[model samples]
Target: MQSTYQTAALNDDYYYSDILYSPYQTLPPVIQDTLLDRQRIIVIANNPSITQAKLEALLQPTDMLVLFNDFIHAEFFAYHPSAKDLPKLLFFRQNGDSLLHFGLPPRSNNLTAILEMTKHATLGMLFGNTDYQFPLPSDDPRPNDDPITANRVLEIPKPLDKLLRSQEHCGVLSEQHSVVADYPVFADIHSSAPTSGFLLYRLLLAACLEVQQQKNADTPISIVMLGFNNENKTANFWEGHNWAFERQELATPPHGVEIIRQY
Candidate 1:
């Protein structure tokens, strides 16, 4: 399926409509009314498209929202200063989708393994350092004149490998009745960065799962990051690591949520 982001690009103008009731509307009563429902909704926006003020207005009572820093959803999530507190209402980028799809360094990582295993896969890597906040406008390809683009910098925590390699054991979950089973399960994705925006995305998914659980535990929710699509491999082209993407351990769902491998 085409990601919501890819669908947006196909349109003549870059505008995409929100499916939920928007706070941007002039109707305060309407906005107030929807907020009362207190539903778990996932809001995804391209970076720079939203202003701080606008974000503040939307976040007050939202269950969760995911924001992308650029055209592709990689940079902001991979290397943003605000990664730590990891607001349920925010996600951003410091670079591009490539950073997330192709992880940095030695070719022995999970991403490398995937490329080698999946014949003729397409690859991309995205980067994020929990310890480093991406520079707003100081030195980057991002446009310089946007007033909304304040020249700010932040510091995040380190990457996952540092944290995981230091640990002795990691937990594993296997279940067929859970939500993760409904979709074609790829391996679970995780990040080592403490402020890692992807964690927030995971939490947001948790919240959505909670909502789904309240009604029916059997229903499955399908969520794919906006910018990553690896498919239609050619049998003739099989260079290992050429199409690799980085991903860490799978996360265990909180209490009532079960993460099943749907393969």
Candidate 2:
């Protein structure tokens, strides 16, 4: 039997709205095109459940790889070494906590991780924001930098900020957690902001659909995920990530999204 969190992603009720949400329609053309053009997109998240064996069975040479903020973390790469040569895109958080991966000196573990993370990837986009400038740790080793990220920086998709900071909403659903469930969530600090992975999924799905409509032909594209365990994140007043709600959404995700649970 499939665990609720591991159930297949199949729901016709996918909702998209708000000027800041997916279908926001302002993503860089390159990011949009790469995603829509792929036959399959493999999104490897930070969840520890992901393993090399599981990925070997699902990953294909033609499949695009998508990883989040910690893509430059040595621990992350050590944990999933197959992901070291990412040839597609990377989305990262610019918040203080995430800066350590990029802020340290070149001699430390930062440079190697940066090179391995970007050498093969076409683009590296920032997902969150901070008061400080975007850190490009690889700039020290300037000659080795990839142009897409070396020269340009992407702002947080407005929808992302809106969705996260919106007091009126709860992740994919607008209802507050208190209203959505018989539980308590501190609205100010503990509101349910959808995880970056979830937001990325919505963005890619909408982009693919848009591309198909423009081509006037169906292009089969899908987002397959590995190691996305919301079970570890809980939504009590103290736990912030809206673990309960996100798990519920993933349990019944809309079409074109697949959750590869362990067999």
Candidate 3:
């Protein structure tokens, strides 16, 4: 019953080239260009099997957090960045979209749906360009609390909550009626697997919530992460982080997206 699908079904669209630098962690000029103008991104990992630690090594801390979910393109994007590469730390999304997506290498039309979600997506990319196995610290320090196994919503930081609360486009019940009108999505991260795609969606919303809550009142530029999980079913404050299998009851809208803000 837990079948994976393409980023398209989730209404995600964007062109991404993993390993732009080839063995280097630096992003491609196009990515840099897009990021310079906008910071918030809704990356679609599509595959969680890939190691995000290796990929983190390449990104600057200013890059922000990565929300982990789904299983679409596992091999292409994860495992590129390493802890050292993070020039800045960005947050990830925590909401769930109530939509059913099918398989990988989705049809062109599905790709179009992924594109629709990208309207406000600034930059999205996978963790690593190659399938490198690397050890990474879990988001939760407690071993008993494996994020993937525990299907529950976490309390987003105050900063992130503030941002999401401030925005009107955080959650979208329909694919066509999303935050697209709010802004133009810059990039979409891609990898070789499907789970990574789910993670990317989570990261996007989480980052947005963080930025909105923490940025200085005078800060001119900010980034927003947006994502929707279809399987999330929790009454604990609309935070998007949840487990697919644990969810049995249907959500109110039957769909939800969490937006995280990062400064």
Candidate 4:
């Protein structure tokens, strides 16, 4: 069966939306296992100031990296120059975009970029819906930009509608659902609405904390968040997303996660 994320790709329609609700369940099994295996799980955000050189100095071959959204775009490659030369680390592309099969005979640019990405991620480039802040400029390769491109970026993530129907590697996250399950308090705290980074942050932290509880502090897992901002950068902020709350959350790092502020 497909996992929640694999079914998480593209989307449309609003009646079926989960309404910012989140419930966690062990950080997706594969992600859980990844926590147990890697010494570190670095989540890279597209804040631009975060460069590949900076990441390379922090990452090891045994470490795991997570990239989402337009990290596959050329801008990312330019920022992280010689990214293809980075250590052979295992990684996960927990897609910030929902997974909709854009059937165009598979662009090598897409596939090659995929392949070059720590080998398209040993974590199998998991897919899931990360909440989108409307009116934001899209960086995805498409015919146009903004509303239309972002609209087609997903088909409509009926995640709650199709739970656990995809493979473990290609899992789906009910976005807010995935967050609430493990970190209910975090998810429910003061309208903490944001994008996938918040959800993915909680998801990975949940898994790491779980393993940490097993007393693996002899070699504790470290989570470093890079290229993240604590304030809203968009001209139009999405309603209901408490940027202040999210900023607070990031400012006071949780689950041993470190924030390297570049902006």
The 10-residue segment with the lowest total lDDT in model 2: 170-179
Q: For model 3, how does the per-residue alpha-carbon lDDT over 1-263 read when each residue is reduced to its tens digit?
A: 21122122222322223533121123322233344434434332322333454343333445543333233332223223232222222222221221111210111112222232233333233322221112122322333423332332233344333333332212211211221122222234221122333333333333233233344223212323323334323232222222332122112211233232111
Candidate 2, 1-263: lDDT as tens digits: 32232221122232334544444243443455565556777877765556556665676655777666534334444335454444455554333233322222221223345444444444434334332233445444442432234323333344433432332221222222111232234477633354566656555655555555555554446778766754544222335445665577678655677887533
> Model 1 — which ten-residue stretch has the worst lDDT?
168-177
Every candidate's lDDT: 0.28, 0.47, 0.28, 0.46
Q: What is the lDDT for 96 in model 4?
A: 29
User: Which ten residues in a row are the worst by lDDT in model 4?
Assistant: 100-109
Name the regions of candidate 2 deviating beyond 4 angstroms.
1-26, 72-86, 96-111, 130-132, 135-186, 190-192, 233-238
Query: What lDDT tens digits, residue by residue, belong to model 1 across residues 1-263?
Result: 42242233233343214412111121122222332344433344333333443433433332323432332233332333332122222222223322221122211123222223122211122223222223333433333322232222122234433322221111111122121222232343322122223333333343344334444534423333332223323232323222322122224222322222211
Q: Per-residue lDDT of 1-263 in model 4, one digit per residue for the tens?
A: 32232223111111123523322232445555655667776777756676655665766756666666445333343235434433222222322242321211111123224434434334333444432222112334442422343223332234411322334544545545544333323344443345556667666654554465555454347778877776667543655455555566667664357887764
Better of 3 and 4 by lDDT: 4
What ranges in model 1 sit over 4 Å off? 1-38, 69-210, 214-263
Error of 4 at 160 (Å): 25
True lDDT of residue 260, candidate 3: 24
Ranking by lDDT: 2, 4, 1, 3
Evaluation by lDDT, superior candidate among 1 and 2? 2
